[model samples]
Target: MSELPHNWVKTPLTNIASVEMGQSPDSRFYNLNGDGLPFFQGKAEFQTVYPEIRKWCSEPTKVVERGDILLSIRAPVGPTNIAPEKSCIGRGLAGIRSETGISQAYLYYFFKNIEPWLSEQGTGSTFAAVSGQFIREINCPVAPTSEQARIVAKLEELLSELDAGVAELKAAQIKLTQYRQSLLKAAVEGSLTADWRTKHKPAETGAQLLERILQERRARWEAKQLAKFADQGKAPPKDWQKKYPEPLEPDTTDLPELPHGWVWASVDQLSESVRNGLSKTPNTDQRGFPIFKINAVRPMIVNFLAIKHIEIDKSEASDCWVEVGDVLATRYNGSVDLLGVFAMVKDVPVRTLYPDKIIRMKPVTGAGLGKWMEVCGNVGLSRKHLVARVKTTAGQTGISGEDLKKTPIPLPSVEEQKYALAILEDRLQSILELELPLEMAFKQSTAQRQNILRAAFSGQLVLQNPDDEPASILLERIRAERAAKLELKKPSSRKAKVSV
Candidate 1:
């Protein structure tokens, strides 16, 4: 921070700009009809360079002219945007207008360079924010007027190219993601294994497998019921088996016809138990049993590290404990990307309990339906079903447990399920390998962007013009003008008081 070029001087932001902190008006004045001017609040309204207009304010309290630099001063601090037009800013933002000699483009890029610092400066018990005085006191190195223009021009040329490369990398990532989903879609729909089905026949057709699974499911329930009764020293009552509830059948209305030897089965039939996890908020003490946070369940990946330890009764922990081969569906999430997303527990690295935000489906053993069901729920029929069952509460999207249990999944016999899953894993792994370099390139480009900005600000981006006046001289002139203006506004008696 201390190494400055001979002609450059570090000046407080307020000395080179006017920082106007925003004040929100009454809620009654806000409208979605675009009544007066664009109402921008905080991070939500921001895009890469400009902001998206969502709300407008009729009786504007704080306004910023077009092209003013907008800075977020709340919870998520330090993202910057340029005002597209004359706008009303909320309390979450502060608008900055450059001084007469400084370039607005220069100031905008400077803010980008110091975003991490701005975030660190924010302080609050509930939500972090920076005071107007804090922003005013920030020190930045200003270049001479002509040199600033040169630096900005060079930066635009270089960064625009950088942005284009980043865009292509991002597009490749998206296409790869889409391709991977299509492969999974094909796998579950029986198309991926169509060739294998042609060459060989399965020992058990999907219909016969489902029938046998139901019989086994009932027998297991009956045995468990009998054991519980004996443990309580009570004899089994007559017609006890009649009390058992049957799994819901798949509704094939308007559903695509399955390939030969395949049938539709409800998730209810595939799972021995489908239930929500523990609802209690976990403690940070890292004691007792570990429970999963919502992040532990990603699409087909479980990150055991994303868990909290809680002191709960052993029985409660046992009930929510996730086991290997168990399929998990997100019950709800704040992001649309994660809602109704599914993952299977390939391995339980730790004895982890799950939260109410997750739904656990313990796949019926002896059938190789675990991986098949996991792939099924993530795409195809599950997606269509999810659209209808999605509900919003407290700004979160979620699906009900009852609806999840009835989700239809195309069933191939156990052998074919394994066959399809093997092909899927192999193909998905190839896609993942191909995606690795793109991710690394993405990170490298981001670092390169920061590097370019650093070079631009530190008297390295462009050649300095010796004819240009020093930034220090400009600051002095600004100071003198401000002093003269303040003196002019003072009372006549203050002049005599100063002379005395």
Candidate 2:
């Protein structure tokens, strides 16, 4: 603790405020019928005041008045909020009530400064918990009633400005994310690079490219089929001819017109092979086969640094192995919104995938190149398709393998697809670089404002008056009142317990 200047005083946190622990009512008896009072849990107090809570209790004894500060003590600790009204809270929260000498707002901000330390002191095997005793011992700075009011006023004014700037930065980030999605949607539909295409002569339509790729893949399969037949010196099966597939037809329902030399088709038509990843437990070897989970496959690029590895069985290596350029799609997940998420592998030290969860599709031909496929997967059209086909349950939702096979994709000319992807990457990167400094400015502004509040509340912000009553006199009066109360509560003598 630093030495106080003039009339400034320092005190323990418990000396200045009252602390109360929370308890949960029987949750089985909880109802949304609105007959009882609102109850808050740690999660509900993170930032927003949960106006309508799913849990409630009839016990009026647990009710807390408005202006009381609530802090969570479990799972996610340090989430703080002011009680909105007469409300009850769960065991996860500890309520702090301010005395006349302290401002609620001042204490709230002060708690924010100490929350990290409290979290560090939390102890538990399953989940961290901040005991009530630990909370009571936490220390903070306190000033006179008038000084508390001044600090609260100055903090509110400054915090409002910081909050406004943070809100704007967050909104800008959201808009940027939306714009990126829109750009991808437009690119795959040919609108983003259509101007360039209109000026150039048509070499081939997208349908023609798909047809050409189909022919190339069929020829490769047929050659392999014949080679096997010749090696056996036996007649090929009659149904084998029927088993051969026909050329894929363009799906006109795929919205937005395709550019010349581009086409639309079900994702199944482009892939010769498709299956889920491996399910075996992965080995933690530093240099081994690389395996990806659903999280590894993000929007456009696969994050290779997060790969896990497993000791490969020879058969698994021969059949289900992943290679560079293979596209993987998440099939089963609780988050239905992430059902159709796709990513292409760029480098692989080892072949890996979990069985029955992620679908691995190796394109028959080169039409599904890395750069173009990334744009196609994240494009707006694909997202709409994913939303429609994904399976949704009350608590969870996700896409299935069959749904993934039917995902509608726009085929772009190999040359134009490359160019469009390059432009999008450069433009998006530049926008992010331009916004980085604005983000920094917002952080610095808040820090400077907090310093102002600290100074004001500590009496350094405003000059003191020599004629005014000193804080020492106020302390004496408080001590006198406490002593008088203790004198009246002197306990009657009872038989003291001796060693058993």
Candidate 3:
């Protein structure tokens, strides 16, 4: 550690603080009914200074007093929050208190400086965690009380400004997202092609195109049935076409009017099939067929790297295998944000199947159908439709295959669909390019925050006043006071023998 400005003391936390590790109370004491005190388990709702209280404890155990530093100690280790009031903390956290001559704010800032190092040092098998002994052994640079206060005051001033800048950048990114979604909505509704429509006319109107596709859809089904009948060496059944299930038509009651060459269509009318994938729990082994986790499907982005290898053969999971141009939709999720998200299968380098929590929609060949479906599913109205149908059966927010098949979307003639998608892609690519620098700036600002903390602790941020007492003298007084306190707690020899 760099030398502190003339009067600071660098010492292990044992000298200037006490560590109180938390322990969970009985399950019966845990309640959401606002019983006794707010309960904090891990880092679920942790924020800048304090954790937002949700669950409460009827009977408190392992409590932290107000202003104590609350440290997360399990799974994700080394983050800290402060206690706003006396509250119960579970095994995931430990409370720290500053001793005499040290500011609690200074201690909190010191912890913030060392977070990166602490994260690396945490150890465990199932979940990485830090022991109380590890926390106590960490060295903290202590500034004299007055200077500590000065440093904290300056940091808060500078950091508040930095935080504001970061917040603005985040808001900008959100605006980009909204703009992207709006572009897709406009493209599908033919707003983007309004000028193009005045110049170029489609050979087939949207209604006529829909009629042609429906005829093709039925013809394929009839051919499959005919082949089956021929294999049986018997004549085809009379009126076999009557047995074909008609594709679902969209309900246009509440839908808005489409452009002259466009019409509303159900996903079922546009797609050949809507089906769910395979389900096998405890199937991550990095061998056999690759299976996509729900995370692999984000809005217009599918990452094959976020996949697991399940111990199932390609043959056994044949029906679940995804081909190129297929659309994957998140069938169920805990977060509603992911409910209607869709991504197209660009390439299957290795054959893969999706989980049951994902629904696959294979569009009728030709007409840029797969990409159009992916775009339509992620549009604003479709998102609202999917969110409205979400059912929470046993703690999951999700949609059914039937829901995907019945969702309404605008359909344009094949020529117009291709043209709109090309324009939308060009605009969206520009937005993606702009986001690159914004994402990097967010990361850089976070590093700058750490730099500010480093400067403050190194005594480069605030000046030292020679009139202030040196930390060594303050430490000696604190030590003496602790020794006196320890002495008073000891039993005299005569009393000890009597008790024994």
- Of models 1 and 3, which has the larger lDDT? 1
Q: Which number leads on TM-score?
A: 1
Report clashes for each candidate as comma-separated counts.
Answer: 0, 14, 0
Q: Kindly list the per-residue Cα lDDT of model 3 for residues 134-165, writing each as its tens digit.
A: 88988888888889899999999999999999
lDDT against the true structure, each candidate: 0.88, 0.69, 0.86
lDDT of 1 by residue, 9-87 (tens): 8889999999989999899999999899999988898999999999999999999999999999997889999999999
Error at 159, model 3, angstroms = 2.1
Off by over 4 Å in 1: 484-500
The reply for model 3, stretches above 4 Å from the true place, is 1-10, 26-35, 123-126, 225-242, 282-285, 458-470, 487-500
- Output the lDDT of residue 206, model 1: 93
In Å, residue 475's CA in model 1 sits off its true spot by: 0.9
What local lDDT score does residue 66 receive in model 3, on the 0 to 100 scale?
Answer: 96
Better of 1 and 2 by TM-score: 1
Sorted on lDDT, best first, the list reads 1, 3, 2
Better of 1 and 3 by TM-score: 1
User: Model 1, clash count?
Assistant: 0
